[model samples]
Target: MEGNESLSSAMQERGLTQVELAEAVNTRLICAGHEGTVSDRTIRNWLTGKSQWPHPKQREALEAVFGCMAEELGFSPPARRQRPATEPESPVERRNFLTATTGTAASAVPFVGAPPQVGTSDVLRLRSGLDALMELDDTRGGHEGLERAALSGAAEALDKQKLGATQRIRLRLFSIAADYTATAAWSALDARQADRAQALLGRALYLARMAQDPVAEMRVWNSYAMLAHQRGALTEAIDSGLAAQATGITKRDPMFASLAHARTAIGHSNLGDRQAALRSLGHAREALGKVDRDQPRPSWMAFYGPAELTAMTAIVRDRIGDAAEAEAASHKALGAIPKQFRRNRALATTRLALAQLHQRDIDQACSTASNGFELMTGAPIPGRMRSLLGDFYRDLITLAPDAGAAREWGDRYRAEWSRA
Candidate 1:
């Protein structure tokens, strides 16, 4: 069957109406913490070929829901273009390098030659560029545009393989490069491109190892844990988290150790080991207490503060069905989270809503949920946040099927999805 036909057949097999399919897709997007939402009209257009190629995010949701690739669903992949030799030293060139180095192309290394002599100024420029990209990610979600530019720039710089640099300078460059690579990998994970994320993370891990920076190595391991946790690989997540903790301990970095322990707690929580989760959380708290507030932290770990830790605690508590404690922790998290981190605020609100629902406060839960939804406007939602909202939506419906507030909340959610 052709793409439309294949899609239709899949829908038919699942007995999903166009509206149902749209809802399913939106639910998935919400769970993932993505920004855009699909409407029934969009799905109808896709089916009727009125719209040919959905956005990559939309395509990802459709592929996930239908269990098929874009090609299998009758959507043609973009035509490949050959890269020109001796490309300009621009962001575009760098992004191309990143795209080329990842996925199936990973086995093939791009052309490398001794070109420019590396200097301190060059390293500083690269560092500033990465800092800008990271700032963009923190303020806005991981937009493909920014992520591509950052990834490409870092890859291009790394490809130069600066020779004759001092060992200290070389290690610094490698550490910075690895951090940038890890950030790109995180962006891939947020976009639901698991293969790309894995490839980037693998490269980052190598760079970290080469740099011999325990802090950088720990950061990579923590990122690996997050990726694995997001994909539901609990054992791998825990193992990575443990590895990070080991590095933190070896480095004697309290902040890194605290964050690593919290990550381990998440893994334990996901595995339904409440006792283990709580114990790990306590360890995190203890390590965090020992952290000197005056010391400078690595850029990657800079966001790991009391607010983040509190939010994590709420997540673990909620997982273990400690509704009251979860609600308290969620409130504290929300209060402590910085205004600039809109996504984290939204996620904490979601947890608060869930906690309220657990307490059978449907009205309060709906209000809190509505607030969370509002926070997501104009921001790219994470899959985890979307998933949390989806769960809240489902629970609201199940628990209060006949309540007017629940119905209103549902209508608000659907309207938001349609507009998304």
Candidate 2:
């Protein structure tokens, strides 16, 4: 049998390795009250066409994970299992039966004209698009297309929310809308358009409150903290980070709590509160230690693991003028960060370069900084990363105005900077 190119391409686009894909499918299985038994070997079998069709439960979980039909992922039913064309489902029967069952299988088809009866399946379908968007953001950081697509998703969710749904379904739709809006805000922030992000985040927060979704609320607060930090509003950043920590999701998920604490630590350090910052950093580490790695989480949070926390620690240490400690933390982050996260790797490289520069390792700093450009060779540098690089460039010239190495560094990256 030929390899499952469709499945391979899907995984590649999402930057998911076979092991990660297995883990994600298993997480969804566990969430649906099934044993999370999918393994990397099983994923390999699927990719190699050793398994043409997954078990029914696994299929459902895969559909949920990818937000598409099993067939779309290159799975094929055996001849004996294929439904006969002679017994085809009529349009009305298909519609009414699907509306009654509220199954996610119907999600492969888009709703046309009037919105059909909304249900759990509809929410899952919408979330699939969000999952794709999140993957794109991870690969490319931020761009205008991402922001526009997020807003369109939000609009679609809102449109469906008004078309007769159960109270629970209605709230879930609102939550989805909030999630989409928050994604838009995040994209804007990554693009360094702080004002646009602020407005979108405000709207997202309001929608999240309406839905009473603590997770969505926490996501918005996290973005708000980053936006505040970008604007030099350290107090506001701290407050927003604290708000994220206060969200109910943090109480249930230690990983999320750790992220909130880490964000708060950055604000505290930047505000010159070294004691408070270090305290928060300690809290972050403690909470991270208690996280349940096997537990299922939303796709948006795939980036916030130990690697990201270590990166945050580097930022905090840098802000507190602990150059050596910052450099060590940055090194740790780069060592642990996954290869698929090119933007993150580049960002960490820039941070490492900054630490080296602060330590007066002029030649070494220039070399380290150049690695960021290499990491993101084919991709456009994100605005936030470009800003960080700009910071490094200015500091380099200021510290070594007459150094040949500094002049060489500028000559090399000048074209790259202008292109970005």
Candidate 3:
């Protein structure tokens, strides 16, 4: 029997382990007044094609859990009553059909010898891959492997887009490609590979425009703003932030608008426009306050909630010479940030250290900065975080060239830096 790629893809998209899926199915089954007998082995069987058709009640529970038909999850009926695979339904049609028969379920047989077709299933599969990569980035930050993997995903989407499909599906594939390329660009940017990041963002923006996806386009422009800032093109950075603000998604999603405003604030602060920077920061906070926290957002944007916005505020405050306010913002960000976001926490720790250093709390700054190394002990520090540490080191030495704490902090970081 052929493996059930569709079901596997769906599970991956939901970030479900075999045990989790089984538990979910059992929960639904219990809610439907049926025995909760499904186990991890059952899910494994389904994935490995050891079970082509599950019990009828189990099928119903699966449908309820996934909000789609069993056939779409790659299950097939008995061979004696097998049916041909039909053309994939449009998203609207498929949703409507599924909703019309919510509690009922049936299975269909697949064609063993047919070549794989590019459709919604492929889209789901690619999206699952993207989700996994994004999670990896959250924990480890950016690396060469991540950049290459992201480019590979973009290439896969581009290749799939060349195949026969509806306009909607074609656009989705192009959008996926843009998202993947943008991820690659961000990875390179985090690694301080400015030239490589610039080239990738250019391609991502073109693909985003081709896909007519304002959210993806906004993401590209946000990255463009960051890349410009890294290259010391502060004016271009501000313009790019404005370009992000101009995207349609920013109008529709307050969270996106807030992020755009925050980016602009950074640019303005660095360019010595203290009044404009604070004004933009206020706008960012106001916009963020209007966002509906319960609304579902794409995985790529999982990083930009209150904690991230607060961190951005610290950046603005620090740039504009408000060390006390910057220190308070960094503390708030650290408290609000989730523990799973190791990279963000480490970066925030660096920011806290910077703020302390600026205030001449040399001993306290070293202590806070040491926490960054502890937090990211198992992983190589991202270049961006390393650069931040470098800044702190330079400032510390300049302020206290002969201090005992300065010598010890310098010696400690030198060892860490060489290892990194």
Q: Model 1, 280-391: lDDT tens per residue?
A: 9999999888988888765556568899999999989988889899999999999899887776788789999999999999999999999987887765565556667788
The TM-score of candidate 2 is 0.74
**Cα-based TM-score, every candidate:** 0.71, 0.74, 0.73
Residue runs of model 1 more than 4 Å from their true location after superposition: 1-116, 162-164, 248-250, 418-420
Give one digit per residue, the lDDT tens place, for model 2 in 1-420: 899999999989878788668756654454344666788899999999999999987777666555566677999999999855664243122121112113334323456786568889878978877787687678778765567557767877897877779999999999999998999899889989999999999999999999999999999999999999999998999999999999999999999999999999999998989999999999999999999999998899999999999999999998899999999999999999988788888999999999999999999999999999988886568899999999999999999989988999999879898645
Better of 1 and 3 by lDDT: 3
- lDDT (Cα, tens digit) per residue for candidate 3, span 1-420: 778899999999978889768856754454344666898999999999999988888887676666676888999889885555563352222221122123433333354774445799878767766776687678878776566557766877887766678799999999999998999899999988999999999999999999999999999999999999989999999999999999999999999999999999999999989999999989999999999988887788999988999999999999899999999999999999998889999999999999999999999999999999999896678888888899999999999889898899998899899644
Total colliding residue pairs, candidate 2: 0
Higher-lDDT candidate of 1 and 2:
2
lDDT for position 11 in model 2: 88
- Look at candidate 2 and tell me the lDDT of residue 116: 63
lDDT at 71, model 1: 57
